[model samples]
Target: MHFQWYPGHMTKAKRMMQENIKLIDLVIELVDARIPVSSRNPDIDELGKNKARLILLNKSDLAEEKQNDAWAEYFKEKGFSVVKVNSKRGGGIKSIQGVIQEACKEKIERDRKRGILNRPVRAMVVGIPNVGKSTFINALAGKACAKTGNKPGVTKGKQWIRLNKNVELLDTPGILWPKFEDQTVGLRLAFIGSIKDEILNTEELAMEMITFLTEKYPGVLEEKYSIEISEDSYECLRRIAESRHCLVKGNELDTNKAAILLIDDFRSGKLGRITLEFPEDYE
Candidate 1:
């Protein structure tokens, strides 16, 4: 299936970010731990040039632990202060304050030299849709200062949230680039539900997912659905439908229902800690 999604709001969001970047001392980027590279908006790097960067591997708990560490190292090597966080559970929220301070220490020192003191670091929180930017902000702030939702595009505008005397966060709506140059990037984003499911073909997406699992994570589907693995992804999906009793009219396999179920399982970590991309591959 061809994957492409860039709603009109994203253009507005990108313009807003460009305008606001001057006011911020740091850019706190959130990337899904499952597909870190694909989930990143390349425009952020351009818009945030010369700004200190902190990349939070959001939803790290849903990804493979080993891959999470590798991804953190990869971003760190690229000069980003990286943190692995499960924002929903507040797993790495506590350390963020210190890390933020560390990331912006140079700016803080520059401010001090100019007789500025106790200036709260202004950070812009950014990420592609559904990478959990709002959730991370809420977790760090210890309150629901930003709207949180399971789906993408929940936060439509910018809202500045004061975390403490030392830090403030500008929460922005999730934004995707106008187009993905590589279809693989689009596909990976689609797999992680960054793209809206309404525009997608669930059956084809499920089949794509099945193919990936069969290649990279063999035996997972078999163990989860209690079905023998099939060479064809459609056959595997059919088996899943039969095994899970996803039937529509008169015992006919409801592949759509099964597709949704499979995607949901992957998203919610029921399929286990799976990371679709690896740092080594990028190297």
Candidate 2:
């Protein structure tokens, strides 16, 4: 299914990012570990030029560990200091300070020569909506300093959080590009709940999930649902409905409800640690 979403507030958010970028020493970008490439807004490359760049693959616990390593390497190859983090659970949060220092070592050395000492690095947390920017900030700061929600556009404005003596964070609202030139990227974003569910067809998205699982994961759905896998996505979804007992008034399979359940399972990592995009795919 074709997919695209660009809320008007995102334009304002982008403008705000550009305006505040000059005030920061680094850009700490968060991307969904499952869809690292798709979750990244490439515009940051331009907005953050000459600034230290750190890419946190947040929600890493929900993604495959092997793929997470590859993704970290992928960004590092692109000259970004990368860390795989599960901000919700605090995995890999402690090392962030050291990594941040490493990322800004050059700037720190320059500051020392200029007689500036102990000045914390100013960083802006940015990403597409629902990729866990505020959550990551909270995890790093060890406090609920930034507003957070599971839905898109929750952190409507910016808030500065003093992470420590060494770091300060500027949390910005999530923003998506004005267009999805490649629909596949959009689909991957949708699968990870980066896009709003209100604008999507649940059954269609579930079908897309079924197709991906069958091809790459193979037999995972069958094992999860205790049902025979089928070549047809609809049949697979129907079997999921039957196995989950999603039934309607006449005892017919409620595929729509099953669709929502299946999608939610994937998003919540109940479907196992799955990564939608691979580094090899980009190469």
The clash count for each model shown is 0, 0
Per-model CA lDDT versus the true structure: 0.86, 0.85
Cα deviation in Å at residue 207, candidate 2?
A: 0.8
Best by lDDT, which number?
1
Q: What shift in Å separates residue 66 of candidate 2 from its native position after superposition?
A: 0.6
lDDT tens per residue, model 2, 16-121? 8877887789998888899988888878898899999999999999999999999999889989999889898899999999999999999999999999999888
After best superposition, candidate 2 residue 177: deviation in angstroms? 4.6
- Best candidate, TM-score: 2
What's model 1's lDDT at 110? 96
lDDT of 2 at 131: 85
Displacement of the residue 59 alpha carbon in candidate 2, Å: 0.7
* Per-model TM against the reference: 0.91, 0.91
* Lowest lDDT 10-residue stretch of candidate 2: 146-155
